[model samples]
Target: MNYRLLWAGAISGLALHLAGLGWDVYRHSRDVTLAQREDVLSLANPSHLMIVAGTAIMAACLLGIAVTWMNERRFGGEGAFGGLLRGAGLPAVGIAAAGSIWLASRADSSGHVHDASHSHGPQQAIVLDLPLARAVGNETAARFVASSGGHTHASAGSFGADAAMGEGSAHHHHAEVPVTAEQLEAAAAFVARLRTAIAPYEDIRRAMADGYLQITQDLPGIAAHFIRLDYRNDGREMDPERPEVLLYTKRLDGTWRLVGAMFLAEGVTEEPPSYFGPLDAWHYHENLCFVGSGVRTVASREQCPGAFTARTPWQLHVWTVPTAGGVFAHDMPEIDPGAFPGAVLPAAQELRAQAR
Candidate 1:
């Protein structure tokens, strides 16, 4: 055997294996859905194939070296240490190869089943509560009728005074206009369908199991957002059954409550869907910087160090819980920490009194 040729092949194979592994890691980091779609040992995955080829070449070269050492020993070699070392190399390589194959098989089978089960299929609808659905529908309709004619009402200064405010002191509100009876009926039907479809997700664990990943920490006024990347990018428009994001609130009792569902448009350029008529006022985030798991709005791209800035898809929230801002309100009033349900936290009552 040519030992020099064997050594060269081993080095090259190891380099190739490392390169494939690194590339796979980078790809996964960029797109998380790849883990759900790609099998660990699939021949169709170029990276997996490269890894297998590299391992095979390295194993073959090591085996050749072992054979050459043994042949030399049989002839005239006399070093005990060298003989023992060469003898151990054969089984070490064999064990490593076996381990790799076993691990890959185990991972492929388990991951494929788990991912396939949760990642696809149509959502099942649940029984709807008629009274609750009607109340939500009526509330939405009332808000629109009250705000018709494009009039802006001043926000009560006393509300949310104690809570930490965002960039602007002035509250921004969208004007709600009246809709046709047909539009109102459609909006009600949409709400009923949404309530039933999202009933299963009331339990946070079930939501997580269905691929809803939490993207933000709990806020005092607003709920945390748990986004499902697969649904967000699947090219479907305004699917109430498969919302792009779920809103959750952590109660004082250490339980998570499902507050609402958020829908997303395909892109900022795309017109927002009118699934709920004029009640659904779609909005988008701009100048937002994301790093690791955290995201925040930045003045400009230059302010985001070690992070990337991008405008998010057009989004609209549909609140299940009662909020001061109504069903389609952009912001929710801060809830009392001690309150059981959705009681609004007391704002600066002194400010209200002074205003009066």
Candidate 2:
């Protein structure tokens, strides 16, 4: 019996399983929540392990063939049957060993599943404390939106007030025109146009590569591959802060066609869904920045607008990313949840086309 094949099969399986195990241990020691764990599992596709099992079984069979190949010439001998049994034994053992290792890899914190995290891609993320995020909640988000809209580090007086009232203060008021039914109708129309634009595109992958790319060509300096997109909307909310439910890519269509209006904000936040997903899951609050009378810099985050222009209302944005890069929740923040719940869709669709 060639033990080399037996050990080789076992070792390969063990290494992969251990890498997964490490990530799992990290999540549990840190208390990754139920919601976070669920999303991670989706990437794992525990069911996908069944595929792994098939490959492992085949590998074991192949080893048996290798060993049996050595014994094929002994076919006429009485020991041939013994040789066959011995040849098949190592691989079978290897397969069983691999299965056990893989099973022990993903351990549900509650002690249900065998693993904790799933494989999405390379992730080097730092998860900020959720409590800190809650501490900054709507106030931070609202300010971020305003700053991105060109309300920079100016005093409350600069925007018209005399006192330096904190952001979104009771005294800080906006002459926000009432959302007229006509404006709402127009928003609805935009959503309808978007649905039509995307529906013919088959799926999210193609749409992100082509459709979104074509529409945003008017905007400059975007790498189709360097970005990813996702969208969500949970209908009207009395407060608009509390989450109602989650969105699904499988059942996404016409229903998302009912957007009202989109608001641009300043800070890049640490929200989910839009703020995260795969490798390119970073959300930047995109607001129109003004340089005197000129407006530019529609795309590309790190790049500044221009040298000759004054970037006053510089579309300030705060980016939110997962603690572990691709490790973000499904119910993450939608780009423009209130307006139409479809802000990220268009951009993502453009990239999806490029991929195709």
lDDT of 2 by residue, 291-340 (tens): 32123443343353533212221111222221110112111222111111
Best by TM-score: 1
lDDT of 1 by residue, 223-339 (tens): 667889999778887887899998876533334678788888886664555664555556556676665444556777788874554666667767776554455544444332213
Q: After superposition, which runs of candidate 1 have C-alpha atoms over 4 Å from their true positions?
A: 1-176, 251-254, 305-307, 334-356
lDDT of 1 at 31: 43
Alpha carbon lDDT of each predicted model: 0.58, 0.31
Question: How far off is residue 354 in model 1, in Å?
Answer: 45
Query: Which one wins on lDDT?
Result: 1
Backbone clashes in model 1, listed as residue pairs: none
